[model samples]
Each structure stands twice: as C-alpha cells, then as structure tokens.
Target: MDTGFFAPLLTGYEWQLSLYAAVGIAAVTLIGKYLVLLIPAFRAEHARNAAMRRSKMTKPHYAQNQRWNRRWGPVFLIAIFVGVLPFCLTAGSQPWWQMLLDIAAILLVYDFFYYLVHRFLFHDGGLLGGPLMWVHAVHHRQHNPCRQDSSYIHPIEVALGLGLYAGTIFGLSRVLGDFHVVTVVLTWVAFSQINLHNHDLWETDRFPFRYLATMSRMHHNHHARFTGGNFATITLLYDWLFGTLDHGHGYGKTKVAIRARSDASGIKKPPAEAGG
Candidate 1:
C-alpha cells in the first residue's frame, strides 16, 4: 500500500485511485501513439499502407479497424482496468518488499496460462483442428503488425484475453490475499505498454541476445511468420521451459524460409533476423 509518491496520501481509496490512474496512463499513452501518424516517417507509412490497401496486398490495417479500435479500445481498457476490476487490494496489508513478489507472481502465473491459451486455443495447440483458434486468427492476419494493431482484435478474443488478466488479479486476491494496489496498477501498465511494444515495427535483431528489443521482436514473430511459438509475454521463461520459444530457430527452416519470406514479401529479412 501507498507505494507511490501520492499513494500514501490517498489512504483508503488508494487502490481505486490506482486503478483509475492506470486507465488514464494507458489511455493517454495509447492516444499519443495514434498521434504518431502525424510524424513524417509514420505519415509515409500511412501512404505505403494506403497503397498496399489499394492493391489488396494486405487486410490487417483496414481504416475501419483503426476507427473502431481507437474508439472502443479506451472504453474497454477502462471497463477492464477500472469498471470490471474491483477495489480488492488490501490496505497496507502487505509489506513493501512483498510488492516485488506480487508483481513477479502475477506475471508468471498469468503468463503461464497465457502461454497455454496462446499456444493451444490461439494456435491450435497442435490439436490439428484448432477449433477455437479462429477467435485468435483475427490478430494473426498481420504478419508485420503495427502499433495500432495491438488492440485490433476480435471482441471475443479481447474478452478472453482481458478476462484472463482480470481473473488472475481476482484469483490472486482470493488465494494470496489482496495485493498492493500500486503493484497491480504498475504491473498492468507494464503489461499494456509492453504488449504495444511487441506489435511495433522495430527491428530488434540488431540487439544482443535476450535484450528487451530482441524480446519484443520475439513476440512480434510470434504473431508474424512464426505463429507457433513465443507464447509468453513479459518473459520467455515459459516459452523456453515448454520448448515453444520459437524465434525462427524455435520453429522452421532457417535460411530457406527466411529467403522465401523475403522473396515472397519483397521485404528482406535482415541476416540477424533469420534466427532472431
């Protein structure tokens, strides 16, 4: 409790305020991201994407999608992070040191289940039929996802995804006693922000092994050409442990597939990107 500079001052309502604050921060950052289209580079991307659309080269970046998602994303973000979420965190119940444990525990626990859902339900989980995978297919339509594409998910998938997060917090509160409000809010912010970063157009292969940038591309690849592995977000521990940590080598033919993807798409995969 009262971990942040102003959290101590809020007292009884700290958890609720933290929830609202998290929503505000996420909302502002996301809206600001949309404004990046005004930038010259991103504006050029808009033009290229328009051409791609004219030629029907891609369907993931539809104008209707951005319109709807921009309007609805914040609403759902608020609903999940603020409205549906309860003020369940206890007041000064856990020590400050436990906050770290709370963050790690929630992330690990959540990512474990996320890995399962992402691999099994989202990617068919090797079930051959993958009936439920269609709910996730809307997201995978983009091999090279843009930042706006992060929230551009089918509503059903959004429910399942956000539900898992909310369910984790509720479960942790019930099983482990209410966690610190600031901890949960901060964790959510990190989760949301990183989830967006995962969809960015950054070329991370230039970075060293296990670097944050590399890890972001690892997630990007999960949504892109290598839809099978890298199921975990925030950490690769689950992917690595479960043998699903696909970063090119984690899945398919290396040089051949790389060249094929390059040749087919005309977007050359940097040499370092071949194996990520």
Candidate 2:
C-alpha cells in the first residue's frame, strides 16, 4: 500500500484546516476568559473594590491552585491527548457537522461519567474514604468558588476523573470509528472554557450565563451547598434524570440554604438573600 498517497488525502484539507481552527479557538477562549476576570481589577472604584474583594478571596487560593495545576494539569492534559490521540489524529477528515456531533457525544458521555464518578468519590465514603474528601472539600468550602482552585483536585482524583473518561472514550471510539474524536474534544473544551468563565467574578456584566445555565447551576449548587446532587458539568439532564437536581434559591446574587424539609416539600423556590 502507498502510505505517501494517503498522507496528502489525510493532511490535505480537513486535518490541517480544522486542527488550526480548533487551536485558535481554544487559545482565544482562554485569553478572553482570563481577560474578563482581570478587567475588574482596573475598573471604577466600586467595581475595583468588588474586584479587590474577589481577588483577596480568590487570588491566593488561585495562586495555590495554579501551583498544583502546574504540577498536575499538564500531566492529565497530556494523558488525555495520548489516550485519545489514536482516534483523534484522523478526526478532522470528516464533514464539520459530523465532527460537531461527535464532540457532543463525547461531552454527553463524559458528563454522565463525571456525574457518576463525582457521586462515588465525593458521596461514597466507604470506598475512597475521607482523605480524598479534603481535596474536593476545599473546592466547596467557599461560598464563591474560585476557578483557580477548581482543578486543584487530588492527583488521584484528577486521574480517575480524566483517565477513566478518556479511556472510555477511547474504547467507544474503537467501535464507533474516528468521526467523533474532534467533535468530542471540542465539546469538552467548550465545557471547560464555560466552566471557568462561570466562576470568574469579574464577568458580572459580559459573561454568558443564559447560555451556560443548565450545567453552570450544577457547580453553583455544588458550591452553594453540598446537597449531594448536580453532578454533571456540561449538561444537567443527568441530574434531572437521577433526582439530584437543585433548582437553587435565586439568581446569582443570593444564596439558597437547602433543607430536609425543603427537599421533602418539593417546592422549588428562588434563592433568598438571607442564605448568603
């Protein structure tokens, strides 16, 4: 077989073009998200005060989280690429929409896996125990969750969360063919980018909350109160299906204290300021 003949076919248009587009999109998303957070540091007095307040609350923790991320994030990121590379190298060859659907499939599959894994790791103590809890516990400890410490997960926790999902995606791709790899990776990237933006306090005005409400609520509720629900990151369909949906008390301004009685009543109410 002539390998050289297939090289041009594979490298000609789809692979070269889509790969460049994805990289550019990913970079822009990262830069824009960070700028949104940093912008507040330069605004008017009240805005600067609020920004300083958030910086005080979050900057230190974020610095720490960055330390941990530098130590571990690259490892996991590399592992994910390595695990998914076999299938993804050829991902761009398909039509763009098919590529998108594949990405959606990955996002769906991983979100469910993440929900289940989080449930097991955080909620099930008998299996993994309390030490692992501390790492994750710190993330929920604050009323206003910081994006920096968001991924400061225990190394093992990161491995489990990322590795299993990547492995499962790898296994599924073996059967499903290579079409979805690029799309799946793209969707996951979109989810992560949005997740970071949602946590960024600086984006009070420009951030896209309406677009992210479904999945963002899960993390919001997770921080508001560890009510043992809202596990999915990119989609809440899993939570709604599994009965862990926390409608939260109100808009982003207030906090909602969930209770046994409240849970039993089954009445979804807007968040009250008192809870904050």
Candidate 3:
C-alpha cells in the first residue's frame, strides 16, 4: 500500500488539473440528474406530489426548518468539496482495469460504513437523545422527500456523515495505496446522483439500470414507512446481509396494515401520524 506513486503524479500543476477535472465531472453528473426529471412521466409525478405537499402542509415549523436548512446548502457543499479534495489530487499507479476495481471497492466500503452509521448512530433514538435526536428528526419531517429536501439536513448531522465518508476514504488510501483521481471523481459523481435520485419521488424501476429503482425504493421505504430497515445508501447489500431489508408493501398501501399492527401490539402511533 505504498502511496509513493501519487507523489510524482500530483506534483506541480497536476493536482490542480485533477481538481478542475473533478469539478467538471461533478457538474456533468448533476446536469444529467436534472435531465432525468425532464422525462414526461417523472415531471408529471413530481408536479402531482408537489401539489399534494402544498395541500397537506399543516406543520409551519417543518417549513421553517426546511428554509433554515436551505440556507446552509452552500455550507454543506463546501464541506463535501473540501473533504474530497485530497482524494481528487492523488493518482493511482495501477492499470485501468485495476483502478476500476479499486474504485468499486471504495464505493462498496463507503456504502457499508454509511449503512452502519445511519442505522446505529443517526436513527438510533435511544442512544442519541436531546439535540442529536432533534437533528435527525428534521430530516424525517419530510415523509416523502422531494428534490429540494434531498440536501436539507442539520449541519451537525451533515458534518458527522461527511466526516465518516472522508475518514473512510483517507483510511483506505493508506492501506490500499493512492487511488486514481479519476476513480475518486467517478465514485463521487455516481454517489451524488444515486443519493439525490433516491431522495426524489421518481420511481426508476423500469429504467435500463434496474438497480437505480431498487435503491430508490429501499431509501423511499426508509423515509416513508419502515424507518428502521433499508439503511444502505447506494446498494442493499449491507441491508440484506444485516437482515434489515424490508421489502414490504409501499408506504401508501401499507399504512393501514402498519396502523393495525401498532394497535394490536398496544404501541402508540408514530409521531408523524400522531402529529398529523
């Protein structure tokens, strides 16, 4: 895991060039994501959902919090950019095929780590109370999140989550040698698209990349109904491995069933429903 290879590659203007390329790649990836929304079916679906959200807006505090979160969007982006800057400058010495493999490994590791932190740390109310719980509660306020809500999160939660991602990448680089700048950029681009798409209301199951729909459904379930399961961000591998994969019916169709089960068990209704 000698990272010496990156020393020569990143010297002089090479690191700056790599950073510029990463920014270009990221911009293209974002444009592609917006293009997906231009699809007729997706456009109509988003419009309908937006209307519904407006009609059902009963919580003034939720709107206020979202506005507050929106103000911090630039801060979150800066954190992500700064966190990934180092990885973007390093260049791997491996061949193209090997570099691809290493990139896959990094993404897999990231998803696995994210699943653990999200499930055990972020979502675990018993372990994290007071301000921490309140931070997570803000994100959960949007039962069915739209594009705007995708990045709406408490700053503390953002720092913790991004810190874990950066730490994982940096730690892996030490053990696996310098990862290629291309690999790092591509991985981040894919992650950004997948994360945003998952938060959106679009159903992508019928798309050519079937897995996009699967991941989206899993994340949607986490937000809509089964909050305890489906914790993985880009893939369900960790969730399946951990036996937390909940492929039950969609939230809309299963609300009655969930309510019935809660009532039968003598458990109180969820805060979302209770407040609604």
Instruction: Give the higher-lDDT candidate: 2 or 3.
Output: 3
Q: Model 3, residue 171: displacement in angstroms? A: 1.4
Model 3 Cα lDDT, one tens digit per residue, 151-257:
56776777776676667666787788766677767777777667777775666456564665566666766776424467788788887786777654323224456
In order, candidate lDDTs are 0.66, 0.56, 0.65
Q: Name model 3 segments beyond 4 Å from true.
A: 1-18, 34-67, 76-84, 91-94, 125-131, 204-210, 225-227, 249-276
Work out how many backbone clashes candidate 3 has: 0
Kindly list the per-residue Cα lDDT of model 2 for residues 107-173, writing each as its tens digit.
Answer: 7887788777676566542345544565566566555544443564566677777676677566656
- Tens digits of per-residue lDDT, candidate 1, 135-192, equal 7777777666666567667777777778898788878877887666677766777777
Cα RMSD (angstroms) for every candidate in the order listed: 8.5, 7.5, 6.3
| Clash number by candidate, in order | 0, 5, 0
Ranking by lDDT: 1, 3, 2
Runs of candidate 2 with Cα error greater than 4 angstroms are 1-62, 125-132, 180-185, 198-209, 213-218, 249-276
The TM-score, computed over Cα atoms with residue i paired to residue i, of candidate 1 is 0.68
- Model 3 is weakest, by summed lDDT over 10 consecutive residues, at 267-276
Best by lDDT: 1
